[model samples]
Target: MTNSLPEMAEIWQQTLNWQPSDHQQAQFQRLYHLILEGNRQLNLTRITDPQEFWEKHLWDSLRGIALKGEFITSLKEGASVIDIGTGAGFPGIPVTIIAPNCTITLMDSTRKKITFIETVLTELALTNAKTLVARAEEIGQQSKHRQAYDVALIRAVGTASVCAEYTLPLLKQGGLAIIYRGNWTEDETTGLENAVKQLGGVIEAIEKFTTPLSQSIRHCVYLRKVATTAVQFPRATGVPTQKPL
Candidate 1:
């Protein structure tokens, strides 16, 4: 098995029109090692092979936050970001490494996972990133975290509507939520539309793309928070998944 992530600079430039600096490259490589090590004690992730790790975990994570040629401007402008259910800190950690200006909070209900991420952040010396041990439903009701972020990211966490419920209440009006998925359909879009609208968000755009290496289908649903979410949101822990929107 390959044990090292390839420094695919050309792939980065060709696909996202963005390239990591030498320091960022080193950080990415280090991140790969750390996740592999952490996987032994925790069921962190199954994508342990280096090449697969780079494409699925690193590139795919960053792709969700970018457009054709540029990253979301808010990220460059020191946006406050929250990654709901950040199990292994894919996009949040990578986003923190590349866009040091943004402040990212990696939240997960599992304490062990958050503890592992805390170690990763410390070892990486990522001052801009922090870890949170809490459920999205509970955090959305907390005054300190509610509507405090400019952008919210969620991947492999739950359904699109569940992701919206977990992320929307934690964002300020006009904040953006990126929902990452392996596949999407028109029926899913219709369900998501109603769910988001009720959560005070609008379906801004949906992007469909394939990974550079695996060529697997992927979708990113971008929702813009247009109004204040109702206080009842997040509807108690596990309720979002059980009852959904």
Candidate 2:
């Protein structure tokens, strides 16, 4: 059986404990069609089953919405946001669907992914979002993007330490960098503490939850950028991954 927009949305509302407006429902249908169309041209995603889409894609994306009251309040009022390594628009597209006020930059290093994202945005008429094809380090240093967003989000991109270097430089002071990690251990958190502090951020909270279908454990490591990052901190393109703090 195929899961239509209304069916998927009901699952979202039940899983996330929120209602979707009519406009949001329409946006879901748009996304469903766009993703299906894009899948034919390119390997956009492997989870083609509608149930898998609901669990992995929609619910995973809506997990951010669970934090919308606090972690993403700024996005609800027209704040700028960037989704680093937004392959196939995991959290960015769904976040845009729910929070129309946010202006999101969905960025990825691969041209094909950005092409897929741009195509979806155009087909869905999502005017509040844009695409950027660049590495995180390069985008961090660009005059237009540097320190430009209220919040930066990344999912399964890299280690917390390395992801901090890629994401923190793009946020203004007092902004948040939310990193999504799966099954994070205590040792992993301890290992990243120094890197977080070195990057002018403090570990705020590590929220844990279970995915709707798979029941997989997920972790959201929230860090607050308390001060500005040093100009030399990112240390050129690809440095963070090569020599993580």
The best candidate by TM-score is 1
lDDT of each: 0.92, 0.81
Candidate 2 per-residue lDDT over residues 1-245, each given as its tens digit: 15574355565666566766777777776787778878898887887776677677776776854563243567667878899999989889988877778899999989998998998898778899999999998878887988898888898797889988988889998888888878889988888888888888889888888886778888888888998888877778878888999
* Model 2: lDDT of residue 90: 84
For candidate 2, give the lDDT. 0.81
Candidates in order, TM-scores: namely: 0.98, 0.92
Q: Which segments of candidate 1 are over 4 A away from where they belong?
A: none
lDDT string for model 1 (7-80, tens) is 99999999888899999998998899899899999999999888899999999999999965579899888999
Candidate 2 minimal-lDDT segment of 10 residues: 64-73
What value does the lDDT take at residue 151 in candidate 1? 97
Kindly report the root-mean-square deviation of model 1 from the true structure over all alpha carbons.
1.3
Clashing pairs in 2: none
TM-score of 2: 0.92
User: Where does candidate 1 clash, by residue pair?
Assistant: none
